[model samples]
Target: MSDKNREGKRTARERMLAERAEDEARGRRRKKLIVGGVALAVIAAAVVTGVVVQDQRSKPETPAAAPAGTIGDKNLIVPVGSDNAPSVLTVYEDPRCPACGIFEREFSPTISQLEDAGKIFTNYHIVSFIDRAVPGKGSKYAANALGCAQDAGHFRDYHDVLYRNQPDETNDAFGDKAVLINLGRQVDGLVTPSFEACVNDLEFSGWVSAVQQDFDKSNFKSTPTVLLNGQPIYPKFNNEEITPANLVKWVDAANQGKQVGTPGTHGQSPAPTSTASEPNNPSPKAG
Candidate 1:
């Protein structure tokens, strides 16, 4: 071939080689992209599956259907201890309050002992204000369940179990009505169909509102409010650390005409005209 013709052929050959190389590069890039996309999709699917499984595992057990029985009226006063006890101990508590949970854990045993000993008549006023603060209003359902348990004559047991299993303050662990009924299982003969109906229907939710109204009328603030014989237990309000020992001493002193640490924000004196009564009212808002 002539030199010009040879040059032309060489140039064509070079062009073909370059095109082939480019096509291979493109193919490699496409294959890498396809593999990367598939890997990303698998990882995403695994993440979603893991989340679903974790959620299922974390869910509380479903409650069983129980027999029906009387669940009492809307009076939130579930009294324990002797009617003839020398002193009456009234406590206002919210199921979802962490501080209330702390008090229940640390001090309720002593109060129970005092009640059993006939030293004091214990009255529990279950409230639901924490529901206003936390999501799902679990406090309302828990308090309503308390009333149902009261009718079953196992309020204290149910109350204790609830505090023992108290969920995080911000979380609405009690939102599921089933958990409340499940808790009733802890107290034999406590979780009846009537009780279940009461809880599922928010039966004592009205009573919870009443309890809040009474709390408002009493001019007392906060959960776990303890009043001995109508006198506010100052330590609970005064921010003083309370222990079972101190609580015993306070009761002894009150029995002996002495005042425990002077009332903090709500002052104390010769027991004011007794206004302790069953709760009743409409819904309450968060403070």
Candidate 2:
């Protein structure tokens, strides 16, 4: 064997080893590039997700739509009777409340009479807090139906009918939209397609929520919180029992020198400057 031939074989072996090392280094570089690219893509996705979440958090909520002819702050008041009446009667009530049903049964007739005579007008703030307290949607559904009736120009009639046929507080019968629509049949011209759709679609549900929010913010906490010219008058007025006759007497006394307001087409009225006084009994009760 010659020395030169042995040296050539050794050099060839060294060249093959050098080539293998170069290939391995290139493979490591490629792996690092791929990992770095994936890391960048993940970081970009996280940043985009963060931006979207922040934007959603900062966005303002859309305001609720109010019923037709609603007046007062936040358009929460549902006005019934003559808008021209001299005295204002503010009533805070939940439709599913038993105490409110009793109040309506007792005073509805007199209140209707007074409204017809142009003596006073009523501002109804219908709330749905009962739905939150109870596990039913009766309060919200009933209130929404009332809004539908108001739109149909039969608010007073439908309002009276609901109370007259009100179910037990725990029954949640009014939660059924069909029941509400059937009750609308009692009110003439109140069962039109629009009214039915409103009832079924829960059109005024948002408005009911707004009214409940307003009620929560107000001084009164219970249902059937009645006020006459900003003074608490349910159960009693000026320490006198609130019989139908006594209610007349209280109005008469309030309007002793003032002339009775003329009756006009039913509609919304301006917001009163004075706030309602807190009721003596915060708990709800029938008359």
Candidate 3:
């Protein structure tokens, strides 16, 4: 081969080698960039996860403050009447529940009579599930107010007042602290600074939630779930319609051989200065 041709070939071969080296270098740089990006993304994700976990850990859990004179499981019950009564009446209710209002209006007088006579002890489980289904804080607020009333030693009296003044199912009037505080005025010696603060601050909110949780875990589906000695008896019992007469009859039957219970200092319904008006026709389903 000629000298000029050999020189040209050598130069071209050198250029080709240089280009191949450059391409490999570029590939290595790209691989490094890809690996670095992946590492950064993984670190960022881990940091975010850690922050979320830390935030969750830092948040304090709400404390449950049950009312005075509470009894039964988890201190979730507000007892009325006499604990020594032969028959125990378990009542699960919600303040915002229209059916519960009806139950209270219709049966409260009879129940009070029975309590005064020391025939049955009533255990009230106040829940706030209505706030979940309906659009309002009335259930929670009213329940908290009820707790405040209980703390003031006027649960039964204030309970009757609430039902009498109960707003419509959709109305959230009870959500207003002012409304609750004003209602407290109806009960003799209930509207104190502490009672107002308790209602406004939602003092017993955790306790209401606990009661709601218990209701959710139970087999009961709706409010005003009245059980006589652990037996369902609100709407019916033994295939017969439930009435005040039936209730007394059932209690008498249950206490046929047993001695009548004397009224206890706790859980007794005192005579209210005012009377509760009649409840509107409520839905059959008390939810």
lDDT of 1 by residue, 1-287 (tens): 99999999999999999999999999999999999999999876543321111111111222232112211133335676554456767777778877678788988789877776656666676666654434577877887777777656677778899999999776787988998888778877777788788888876555566665555555545666677666566355245445788778767765675222322111001222233432232222211
- lDDT score, residue 30, model 2? 100
Listed per candidate, the RMSD to the true structure in angstroms reads 14.5, 19.6, 17.0
Encode model 3's per-residue lDDT on 1-287: one tens digit a residue. Answer: 99999999999999999999999999999999999999999876543322111111112223367787776556667878766677878788888877788888888898888887888877788877776655789988998888888888888889999999999877889989899899888888888889988988899988887777666656666667878777778688888888888988998898788877677544434322222111112223322
Tell me how far the alpha carbon of residue 210 in candidate 2 is from the true structure, in angstroms, after superposition.
0.6
* Structural RMSD, model 2: 19.6
Q: Which residue pairs of candidate 3 clash?
A: 81-267
**Backbone clashes per model, in order?**
2, 0, 1
Candidate 2 whole-model C-alpha lDDT, 0 to 1:
0.75
Which ranking of candidates, highest TM-score first?
A: 2, 3, 1
Q: Which regions in candidate 3 have their CA more than 4 angstroms from the true location?
A: 1-63, 265-287
Q: Which rank order by lDDT, best down to worst?
A: 3, 2, 1
lDDT of 1: 0.63
Strongest candidate by TM-score: 2
Clashes of 3: 1
